[model samples]
Target: MSATREDVGGTPLPPGWAQPAHQPDAFEISTTTFEQRATETMARPFARRAIANATDHAAALTTARFVGIDHDALRDKARQIRAHAIANLPDYLDQWIDAAEAHGTIVHYAADESEARRIVAQICRDEAVTRVVKSKSMASEEVSLNSALEAIGIDIYETDLGEFVVQAMGDRPGHVIAPILHRTKDEVHALFSTMAGRELPNEAEALTAFARDRLRHAFLTADAGISGGNFLIAETGEVLLVTNEGNGRLTTALPKIHIALVGIEKIVPRRRDLAVLLPLLTGHGTGQQITTYVTMVAGPRREQEPDGPERMHVVLLDAGRSALLGGEFEEALHCIRCGACQNVCPVYRQVGGHAYGWVYGGPIGAVLTPLFRGQVEGGELAHATTLCGACDDVCPVKIPLHDLLLGLRRRRDEEGCVPRSEQLAFALWGQVWSRPLLYRASTAVARGSLRVIARDGVLSAKAPLLRRWTAGRDLVVGRRRS
Candidate 1:
């Protein structure tokens, strides 16, 4: 096999399949077929019910939180604050580093995932870490940090309940805030039973208590704690963690070494900026005025301090963020990981987060994944949205998600990542629509073709070029073309 052939993804190819050298492998091709997966996901009654309930409750609560408040003005201010931060990110980063160092925090810069993981592994080795507890951090997921540490014999425990459930089940997170939302109670009971070596009750309280018991030990005994920073304040050199669970507090406070893996964009210029961001993050994220826990670790515990980490480390991960600065989608950096976009997204509620096939999901995923992972690998995600602008309205930081998705599509076409057939089809469409005579001729042909396919005044799905459209519903051809 040639190099390109050997480089093809793990997805099994059909007999006699021959992909072009430039074409993405079967895995990438499969992601582009999100429509097919979406159909499968939407067919599940449980998934539909669970997602509908979650999004509905979230939407209602978030809307209620904004009552009597000028939500738009807050969004505008958020945009202004983020734009200024992005423009002056370098200066803020340096100031943040100097202040953090002064506060006795050890800060490390990782240019890529490998470096970030290496930093964590080295910290584990230095500490002789046998067990580690983790708070929810998507940055850790981006780097596959758990597996990296596991390879070196470090036992990493996910302390967050949702995270722990997904980890125990050997699955990836389905949603940012609610990882196991798609899972049924029975499925969770079965998973926990396997771990407990007994049959467990399929009840929420029971499962939570079981998990808390398991995590409590991990928190106290852990040699180190790994977390993701929600916001990094440059002025105070503090790393903020916002969570609805107590695990975030315990994981950072109890451990001898606390390692925070954060993206550079998480930095805000001043401490006061958080006053504006916290309410927006919590209100839009979980429909609460404030989360259950909001913890800030300025640095390692000092000799004067009674309880905290002996050493503190912040791994500022680039992972393709620096390149986005001053680019078309630079506003994506403003995301607070609030997950509001996914909650309001029509497509996400149907297909769920897994269909996006990345750490991030929904509108933000459609924009960031493609940019960070490259147009060839993540470009297909751009088509996952309906361009409904619901994501825009719900975004606290006011990132233009729909516009960014369009930009990704344009980038795909410009990079020739779009399939040749699709390009040809659109080219022909443009030619036909641009000319009146050709347009009329094409419509006449289509009408005649539809008539042939029509039965009882509804078109059959067997019609070529109309199968996808007619798959789930009947389409009646209109006599008049406007």
Candidate 2:
């Protein structure tokens, strides 16, 4: 089935994985540029619009009411639960395998992204699938699954509304919970009109209706369905999917073959843990009693069921998660994708997702990127945050996000990954500070230099290597007294 303009409208294509401009070797350069870009972006009308939606007073009040329990106590309990699960991951993995296999589900293990892609591609080729419908899965994004599938001549359709928009626009997700939050209504209207070959309304209801009508056909005609698991229950061998949209239900149930891709860290010891998490996710993400759809698929449909898939496959991916599990950074595995960090983050609130130059954004991205790609390729992303404790405050699983970012920074420093220029600057600063006379002389020179550069108490002229800093804001110089 071909995707209609209505179906693909307003959604950009998935973003190609690439490094962003402003390559900074040292934390100081990276931090400075990050601050500059974040400040500029937040000032834009578009960024303000997106922030309004997330920080809506009504929504915040509703969420506060639902999670009426003490925030600190709940966070502590959730932290302990995740800690226990991570500590005993191996045992849970074994249990998950045994239980899932018992229910006739085929399980595959992948060591990395390439292997994971190969395994999923082989499955599609073996099944002779040409088209697949998929639910939203960050694991899929991490592995670039759609590109891998397309490389093998398979057409994949994203069933989630936000993901579908992103897939069509060919852009990476901007936020975990609200992927298209960076876009304005006007931009979406223009995109939809181009795809639909006609004018489309900018109203939310009209846009949603157009997408629903377009995706309905893909659901009925797809040969296979793919999804990412929110939780893997070891006790019952069930994979749980939590979504605010009903599209997940159709994506998983309507196809002939069903496949789930999950990171190994998603495993939970029992089904009951969901009791605490379901409310937490809703409270932290969208403030609902429950997501619109919560699905638990144990295996393929039984003889009694007439409408479910016949074959079920689960691919459990390691992809650096195993190495991180036993390491000091293991706390990152507790992430539940509630996106509380991004919402509360000053940096993310300003610059949005594109500045981070990765699939994940905000505090979680800082830690995950470095770990996934190693400090050499993704070390710069680690310095994107201000080390604020807001992320820690809102995390349902209570990951110590700021501490993790600091740890990554230390690792980056130890590896000598920092730029030579920044290193030299710090070394010089240290030398001057060691002697009182040298420090005083340096301060005197700085004061004189500021006077020379100042124009009416503001330094507006672009200084050498300081052009970016002066581009937007004025730097005021101190006036001399008689």
Candidate 3:
């Protein structure tokens, strides 16, 4: 029931594949703080190893891809383009809407998550759609669109190979581009074999071929398609999408009705901007010179066109994005979703995306989670980083991730989202450190106590009052023994 991605860009699944999944969403936000969840992830040696290996390899490739190119200048231009777009988001959005409507595409506005969900569900209901096929769309995940459609009795299939695996297994994406970064090929083999009711080959290509077989059927039968926009060109009224696997093209083209849920921040004033942004997006995201399939949809197909959707819909979701327009965190809007920052981030490398407990993870996730979801649900994530500037250096758009993370932390502390104990401890710290005698005396006492508790100058995991920090790290104080 799916498109022919198997022959195109993917080596690509069945009813048994659609069976209920037992695992929670891999991307679902955890109720626990970063410390609690990170500890659990750290305990999973296999998952940690997989995550570290994938990120390091991707990070290295990204570095290699930019070797001969003027990577710095490209990144600077991209940053400028993104910054300018966010600055004039309103003007560009209005222009885009006018242009899109003139080109016969329908546009809908969503003030928040509830409205976006309602709009899409209503469209499916109005169109009498019962089955839907979807491409990988982070924006859809941001609004939890799949569950919403399923709740209304519409059968939804995630058509991209990784997303299809995620859907069948009921897991969320672990990394932005590589969704199953924390999973092993063996895990995929087991799942596919269980679905097939026979032993499948224990290989990547074989596994992909099986999935593609199942999904190709879904592509032809689905009544509608749902996708996310990587960038919206205001001048041409086209939603631009870039993908390595060809599913994005089929998902939007083969279906009679297509819906794109795009964050307002994804808009740009001109199509030419892609000339600068697309390379950085692909290079930083997967270390490719460019994505294999780049699709631009302006509206529905006309009589002359061989194949395309009969109707097109674009949902512009605000959902707290506009509030940051003129704020300190506005620069966070400049992100191109390259996932480069996540690849180089020490925190994300160790814990993966799930520990951030939101749709996104890593340094950008830490900033966006609190800004988009607010402090109550995501404030603690700001501390999930080491304030390391690795993400800042890697970001294709040049977003100041380190500063934005610090800003989120400051906002959390200012809003009393921080625990009372933490607040009190900081207050006491300020009091002690602000005085010369108190600071000297306190440091001396603390050093002596730590020296007594340490073994060979490395503090034990059971170190009093510092257990949390020491438990996951070795605090090497000095070479001298107590």
Q: Which stretches of candidate 1 lie over 4 Å from their true place?
A: 1-40, 437-482
> Model 3, 1-482: lDDT tens per residue?
33232322222334434545654443345567787778877878898999999999999999999998899999999999999999999999999999999989999999998799999999999988888889988888888888888788787878889988888787778888888988889999999887666899999999999878776777887889999999999998899888888988998889899999999999998988999999899999999999999999998888899999899999999998999998899999998898999999988999988888778989989999888887898998888889879999999999999999888888888897877898899899999999999999998888888888888878978777788778767787764346
Q: What are the per-residue Cα lDDT tens digits for candidate 2 across 1-482? A: 54332343245433431111333231111333445546655667676667656645424744575555776776677777778888999899899889998887889999998898999999998888888989999999888888789766677778788887777667667888788887776766766566566788888788777778657767877889999998898888889898888877787799899999999988888888888777777777776768888998888888887788888999999998989978879999998887778777876766777666556878898788889877765687778778878888778788988889999999999999999998999999999999999999998898888777776777874654466667545788876653
Top candidate, metric lDDT: 3
Instruction: State each model's C-alpha RMSD to the native.
Output: 8.3, 5.2, 3.7
Residue 308 in candidate 2, Cα distance off native in Å: 1.0
Per-candidate TM-scores read 0.88, 0.87, 0.91
- Flag regions of model 2 displaced more than 4 Å: 1-45, 48-67, 434-465, 472-482
Error of 3 at 308 (Å): 1.3
Best-to-worst lDDT order: 3, 1, 2
Model 3 CA deviation exceeding 4 Å by range:
1-29, 434-467, 473-477
Global lDDT of each candidate: 0.82, 0.78, 0.86
Tens-digit per-residue lDDT, 1-482, candidate 1: 11221122222223222212233221222354567666766667798779878888888899999999999999888888888898899999998999899999999989998899999899888877877889999999888888788778766778889888777666667778888877888888876675665777889899888878777867767889999999989998899998888888887789899999999999898888877898999998889999999998889988877798999999999989999999898999989898889889988987887777778878998888888888776888898888999999889999999899999988888888878999899999999999999999998898888877777667766656777777645687776545
